[model samples]
Target chain A: MSTNVWNGEHRRIHMQEVGTRDGLQAECAFVDTQDKIALVNALSDSGVAKIEVTAFVSPQAIPALRDAEIVMREIERKPGVVYTALVPNVRGAERAIDARADELNLVMSASESHNLANLRMTQAQSFGALKQVASLARASKLPVDISLSCAFGCPMEGDVSEATVLHWSQRLIEEAGARGITLCDTTGMAYPSQVARLTAMFIEHWPHTELTLHFHNTRGMGLANVLAAIDAGANRFDASLGGIGGCPYAPGASGNVCSEEIVHALECMGYDTGVDLAALIAASKRLPALIGHETPSQIVKAGRRLDLHPLPADFAAIRERALQRDAASAEPRG
Target chain B: MSTNVWNGEHRRIHMQEVGTRDGLQAECAFVDTQDKIALVNALSDSGVAKIEVTAFVSPQAIPALRDAEIVMREIERKPGVVYTALVPNVRGAERAIDARADELNLVMSASESHNLANLRMTQAQSFGALKQVASLARASKLPVDISLSCAFGCPMEGDVSEATVLHWSQRLIEEAGARGITLCDTTGMAYPSQVARLTAMFIEHWPHTELTLHFHNTRGMGLANVLAAIDAGANRFDASLGGIGGCPYAPGASGNVCSEEIVHALECMGYDTGVDLAALIAASKRLPALIGHETPSQIVKAGRRLDLHPLPADFAAIRERALQRDAASAEPRG
Candidate 1:
């Protein structure tokens, strides 16, 4: 019944762009390595806090990101932006380190079935593997962040328990020495209330650790869930450029939370996102040609809320007729 | 700064469907009269609190709803569901009353330029005409509700002042004998903080009056704005089936807030929307066939979050291989 629930705190929000890794991995046409570097370079100037540049998995495992090492080594890195790479094992970690990534991002699913299905390993095995990757990253003096996929729910397993998610998060930090954890809604199964509960729980348990909330717009609750997480004290998020990435299980479904749309919304709501929105949108505009497909970004489709449309061609005539009608009606009906 | 901002109050939300009127009015292809009746009947069973069945405008103005009278008279009205019709003037009010509509919805824009462009009348002229329509409805004992379009922002005028919106709302209620008001985001310009401020202001000024929030998903902030309005104590919303009706000024943009998606979200968030989500989705699925185009409803495309997908075809083999791999990796340091 409280009406004062609008948190117009104007706090800082950390936006992480994941189009190169999470988004490109699902594309049907492979983007040229130079284009990938260009995309990352464009996003770098947009003031995003972090950028997931590429994944160092096996070329056979994910051929789209086969040029990950080259991409990591060649891009003009911005000073304030943290350039990260998704690493699957110690070998991947060594490659990322050699290529000079700012941070090492490791991945596993909170649900057991998703872990096996996605990574061909049980939860325990995946944890063991990621632990070694984390250890290698730590030994190389690099910060390691673990992304726990399906933290909300799994398409194969339905609902993954919060206890299971928290358990893995605790281990990834306590044992693997991960400095941060990302709760990823891998299949867009998270709703706002669930997002609020989980975000609050995570922030309460680990106040000092870096927390990022990643969502997909698969069910159209992406922005709503973002607001809920922000209300529950989450300041970091993962977004994809042009809203590209998550494969549509059915036609017309959306992908990840769009970077430009999220930045636009946060900026409108008085949040300090540190993002140059016009610059971000310009980069998003090239996604369709680069990816050979249209993206689900609403901002890219319909410009920002303040972007006014020109008056209809007959507007001056229409106004004149309206005034004449009003004057004639005032005089009285014959 | 405040983490306890998620108001998970299990309140009852009144969902009013406007697809048959606001949505269909903008379509290039006209839906058949019988089909409109069928759509209304289907939604009647979905437990929505109200339905804007049709608009009683001149066939010249909106040829799409030309058979409004026949459609209204033919539809099987359900008990406990109010059937309303959009009435632009006294003549429209008379026709709506003759068709046995339960309520009359009068509309004008909060912005001057939008009013002239959309309704071909200045603000004062439009108010005078609607006041007469409201009087006619009052005489017939049918409740009159005013819908103020562009209450958030005007597409041509940029930003509509809140003072103008509140001024019109006050006149429509205090002078025009209207019982309810709907703040319409005609071109999807509303953001959350703006929605929060306006909704709270309206609730504060008119605590006893019925208030409905109408939104478009043009910028993908429709549901986020809905959540913000709810936090500010709004209970009624106007949604369109299949997210249809708004003519896309740009390609790949959405129209109105989708009924099934809103019901699905509120139900997930523990609010009692009293809508059968499956039945609503069933109706939304029929939109493409009836309208000859795909709709923007996410639930219609991807199914509900709880609706799990079948495991991948090679899952059993993949699981066996994964187990063996884990077993092999457990024993080794070559």
Candidate 2:
């Protein structure tokens, strides 16, 4: 049995900011293209290393990203910042390439049932489409990352076997020529042990493929799964600011794990994710109004751990006096 | 250098419900004694192994728990359920004993500044008083547990040393004769590394003492810390239903780890906590109105992982039709 150890500095984990696309897409209200650009720019300024700017699906399917081209065009691109776009197929990849996106992300559900329901395609068809997208991206000298959605477990299929996930992952990396694979707890059915087991198996099989984790706080094991993955030697992660973006098909599927929360968790564990939490929270303040609903992120409401609220100067003195009185009264005399 | 291994059937960590005490104490509105009693009875009926019913402190300090004596008396104590009370001093222990509390929980701050600020006494004085209370509890033949608040780190004094926590913990177990020790992330400053180190140290020194963890989600590390503690050999935990409770003095301190969230995390990992999550969520329905604020717990808002909302019968047909359309569009060569 391996024991958990604290070597302090060796505990750092990476965080991916998904606020711009995942967060805004779930909003009931239409965030104007300007506001979307502002939100993306704010997150970029907050020192996030990478931001999932937008998805390139058909405009009719998701009207929220109809201005994806415009928003991508208007945003100020910072040096050293990686801008990624989520593409559903070759058509989406073409738009992303035209928009000059730094990275392209493609996803397909591991469970065949979910894939048909979510993407209007079978698993084989989705993989075929991904291979074409990967070839196109590679031709243009762009990086392509494949995300295996519902890798842990699926809502419709119940428990997903590890062999299924590994089989798809291997096919994607080998045939599609993808650079990295992200295992998503799309329905938040992952337990820590499942995470450790699946992650270990994946790492053992694809020793060279970079692994990232995408989790939902739907069951409140988002961070637990992250820790388990980290322990299994997977470090990269994808999180939405304020935990935005739930699967429209999966009921009770809340957004991706909160970006600020993940950054705070990583930083506290001595991991250098290069994201400023206070700035991230500041960027998240525009979300409630923009999304037309209250956010689910805890740090936005409670403030950061080190955030000190200003108290009345006399408050401490008054409390001290009360303590003194209590001490005197409670002291036993000989 | 230890890697986490996935051993299926690892016993699920036990959860000690503190909703009645810690959850209720932080609310401004006073729940009537009968209502408090009803809540406790409901929790007891829900099959939790232990429930912290109330805290015996001065009414002037915490008026919310003023009717601790009446509430404890009226509870319909279930068989095998350990009813615990949070006692601040010898007088509090006397009252708890009078009320027939199954267990007396003594609290002391691990940080000197927090100890002085919270208890109105130095560490030595608090330890001395705890010894007296332990002696009385032993004479009365009641079980005793010690909770070291701010054991991980403190808001007033950042980065509480591991040596200090272990030293005070040993003192409490040895000198005060505590049957168990609970380390609290009072300000939620504990990272996974810190939790692993402190819990390992405590377990190493006081091998026989039962170690419980009480973590706040203030920094969003509550559940992460719990996983680390579990890996460090801790089995007992203190969680509030719907993640209730906050520290009045600590500005950003908010909500204890949610019971439903923790239960979901454990059960999904194949550990058996023996608590029904749906029933727990049902029991927490009154929490919003009782606290007069919406809780931050995800399970309370989004429901469980497998919880499926009633779907329209047309949903499946609509998805199937969409898939057929896509497949027809793809058949070009024929």
Candidate 3:
């Protein structure tokens, strides 16, 4: 009944391409450090506000990103594009700072079961580690961004309580002074209502902190969650190219929300994302080769809505070629 | 910054399963008549408000639905479910009535290029035909539902004007007494804002008419458009099972939005869809055998978020084998 119902969020949205890190992290084949640089450079050219180049973790922990420093150093950081890296601990923060990362992305699962399963540490241990990383980030003059994995829900545990999310977020922000926070739907268990509720809570509590939404299309609700966040007034998002990446815990599962799909939806709705979709799409094109596999991107499978297909060469004569040629004859036997 | 942002449309939503007709129409294989009956019967039992059983076009028009009458005659329809049939012309309407189809779904593209290219007729000719069908439907006591294909945009002609959509809808309701209308994103060109604007306008003008949205996931915005429509106060939708039904015009392109995906989203957001998701999912499982191919349904690929996988057989040994092997490895990195 009201026109103002859906346009609550009409401001410019910012996208952070995390394909080079989050997307390729769990892949079996090791992408050449040179290819990773190329991907990051291309994504940087797309006018994204941030590019998460790589994760600085133990080489044995994630063999896919063993050359984290190589990628962070090799990428040509464009002006205005913040080059960030995923740091799991103090050691990661040191490496990211050494590589001159503009921001340090520290992650911890909000769910206790996932925190143990994913990081081999309790939530308290993760908080302790993050506290240390936060101090180092402040000393190095780099912003510390926190991502609460499984904030929506967990695979090991069915539902992560909102109380748990709010409590951890308060610790991560109030105690650690995180410059930004991402409430990640790690395995895509998020629905719109949950996203709206949590986003509203976060925005209300920490009005000054940059709130980014990180969603996986594991259940095909990734873009849907993005829409919900937009309505709830969130601006920053983390997305993967070509929808690559899978949880090492759950192989054959989808990774992050496809960056192309997110930007495409926003741009279509007249929202200025400041990212060049054509350039981002061009970057997504190279993902299959870089990752050595076909992608799950819908834009790749189904061209842009404006991309018109040529009419049939025999459009005038094709009516007789329809599959229902015998339907008349099959009708109730005269 | 307020919680009153997105809770605008909290109401009952209805799902119409169009898989048996729209999904199978463009398939290469002709499903067995018995399978069609079984599929319809299963969907009926799933608590869906409507089931589009088959199209009554000339068997010559779509040979895939050659057994429309037989399938319609044999399937056990549920008491509350409305078994609808697609009718292309007067002859199709006659057969649909004979087969006891409760509703007749008549369609014509809004864009003239799509109308001619898809239906092989001009817009005015389609209007004339629909006029005749509408009068017949009134006489036979069957509701005439008109679908304006490519109402959002057309693959052949690009953006169909909003003025054209409103004009045709006005005539269909005022002149033909059409009971319901469907705004079809035939090629998945619809974005959220466009859907919101059009839905709001339709709701404003035809306050009492049943406005249903038909979207294709061609560009991964099908569910997003559904969200926008919901925000704009539309409660009815048409979705295909297993995400079947590719566009013949754009070969290999996705067809209607997956029914499971739509219902999953609505049910997750606390809207009462009335249909049982587990039952719908179980019915969707039989589609591969019935259609002789794998489907694009995400729930099948990723499973529900609540469907947890068992922890690995080597869970204890695997954690000690994490990629980040050392908490002390980051002690200033030497």
Backbone clash count for every predicted candidate, in the order shown: 0, 1, 17
- Model 3, runs deviating above 4 Å: A1-10, A247-253, A315-334, B1-10, B249-253, B312-334
Top candidate by lDDT:
1
Q: Which 10-residue window in model 2 chain B sums to the lowest lDDT?
A: B1-10
| Model 3 lDDT tens row, B46-97 | 9999999999988887999999999988899789899999999999999989
What is the C-alpha lDDT profile of model 3 across A1-334, one tens digit per residue?
3333244344688899888888888788899999889888999899999988999999998999999998898889799999999999888889999999999999899887688777777677788889999999999899989999999998888889998999999999999999999898888898888898899888988899999999988767788888778777788899988888776544565678889988888888777889888898888999888778878787877777787887767775644443244455458875
TM-score of chain B of each: 0.95, 0.92, 0.93
Error of 3 at A286 (Å): 1.4
Q: Each candidate: what lDDT?
A: 0.90, 0.82, 0.85
Against the hidden reference, what TM-scores do the models get?
Answer: 0.97, 0.90, 0.92
What is the DockQ score, from 0 to 1, of model 2? 0.42
Best by TM-score: 1
Give the TM-score comparing model 2 with the true structure, all chains together. 0.90
Distance from true location, Cα of B41 in model 1, Å: 0.8
Model 2: per-residue Cα lDDT at residue B291: 70
TM-score of 3: 0.92
Model 1: CA > 4 A from native: A1-7, A248-251, A330-334, B1-9, B247-251, B329-334
Q: In candidate 2, which residue ranges exceed 4 Å CA deviation? A: A1-12, A45-47, A247-254, A277-282, A285-294, A308-334, B1-8, B249-254, B286-294, B309-312, B319-334
